[model samples]
Target: MLEMAKIVVQKTGEQIPVMYNPTELSLNKTVVLLGQGSNIQFQRVEDDDLTVSLFFDTYEQQIDVRTKTDKIAALTQPTVGTADRREPPVVVFTWAGPLFTGMISKLDQKFTMFLRSGIPVRAELSVTFKRVLTPEEDQHDQGKFNCRQLWLVRENDRLYMIAQKTLGSPDQWRLIAQTNGIYNVLDFPTREDVGRTLVIIDTHGETFNEVGNV
Candidate 1:
């Protein structure tokens, strides 16, 4: 059987499964032009954007389709007391494998069907996601060649759990914390840590394991 496409919240391990898989996807990127005509060159690439249409149907269940699309819309809202930053939660869109890891940049919802009481029974959602890269990666053009395997932090990740996954031992969490300079060793993977890149390097600067980027 074929699997359904879904958006996973990197903060709370919540899985928002779409009613149907996407039939098509659109990807785009921007390039910067530098220098004069002869010396003109592609300066840098920015904003890897992914767009997909999701469909939600609650007709058989006799429920409002907004109940599903609202979850996707919430991802574009800022967290409490963070109005100044306007940073929404990051999410990963996955189907059979990882597709993209980014925050929801644009969301457009259209209700196509309704019940007798005017309750929406079907909705079409157009979601656009902007790819996020680590600061180290963003400065690659500045002679920064330091690249290593990194684990993309996901929802509900604990220090011990990460150590076990990467280093093959739960007791190595302290070593990981020390290597990463994390003071809060006990409560790791804070909300701020989610959707971030994590490197599993030992004190000797040897990598253990990490997931590949999409």
Candidate 2:
């Protein structure tokens, strides 16, 4: 099998850059625009000549829906058993596949990943690399890389799941956040803020003492 590791995405302008300067670039931070749409560029390094396959998680069908009058439909309602309205599966990434033809390179490979409604587009994940060779007993045939896990990117979060997945632990969140220059996680749940919290409470006895003094 092919030995694979976590894939890291460093953000860039939407237009793919023909070349990158490793010195000025941020290694783990990704930039998202504030407007309606954000452009993202991905940079990853992989062993040469390995085939990569893409898998999309299928969404579970919705079994319960409310009517316009606020009435809940019965479980036996015909719509419940009917074939679900198949939403077009958004294509997240399209590239050369080991589904047959092989061979990939170090240069920037371009592709697009699309998001569809009802799907959680943002997520945290653990990537486990595996090698699958086509020939049953061919020792020389190296394997391919598959997505080992897909997870959610919670709200009020900064780092993507890719960091944790790659590192095999959630503690890696700070490394990702610090690399991005986000000092306060309260504002954004980047690494610096993942487990940081503050709380306050008043003592009833202290309140009585103050009132009596007044």
**What's every prediction's RMSD, in angstroms?**
16.6, 26.0
List pairs with backbone clashes in candidate 2: 1-131, 2-131, 92-113, 123-153, 124-152, 124-161, 126-165, 132-143
Residue by residue across 59-161, what tens digits does model 1's lDDT show? Answer: 9999989888888998898862364765888889999977888988899889999999999999999999988776755765332344334778887888888
Kindly provide the TM-score of model 1 when superposed on the true structure, using C-alpha atoms: 0.61
- Worst window of 10 by summed lDDT in candidate 1: 205-214
Which pairs, if any, clash in model 1?
none
Name the regions of candidate 1 deviating beyond 4 angstroms. Answer: 80-86, 141-214
Number of clashes recorded per candidate: 0, 8
TM of each candidate vs. truth: 0.61, 0.16
Estimate candidate 1's alpha-carbon lDDT, on a 0 to 1 scale.
0.77
**Tens digits of per-residue lDDT for model 2 on 1-214?**
4322212211211111111111121113233323354654323222223323322222233211111101111111233122765221111111121111111122222223223533332221211122223343222221112112222334554443434444444444454444445456446755544464311111211221221231
Cα deviation in Å at residue 148, candidate 2?
A: 16
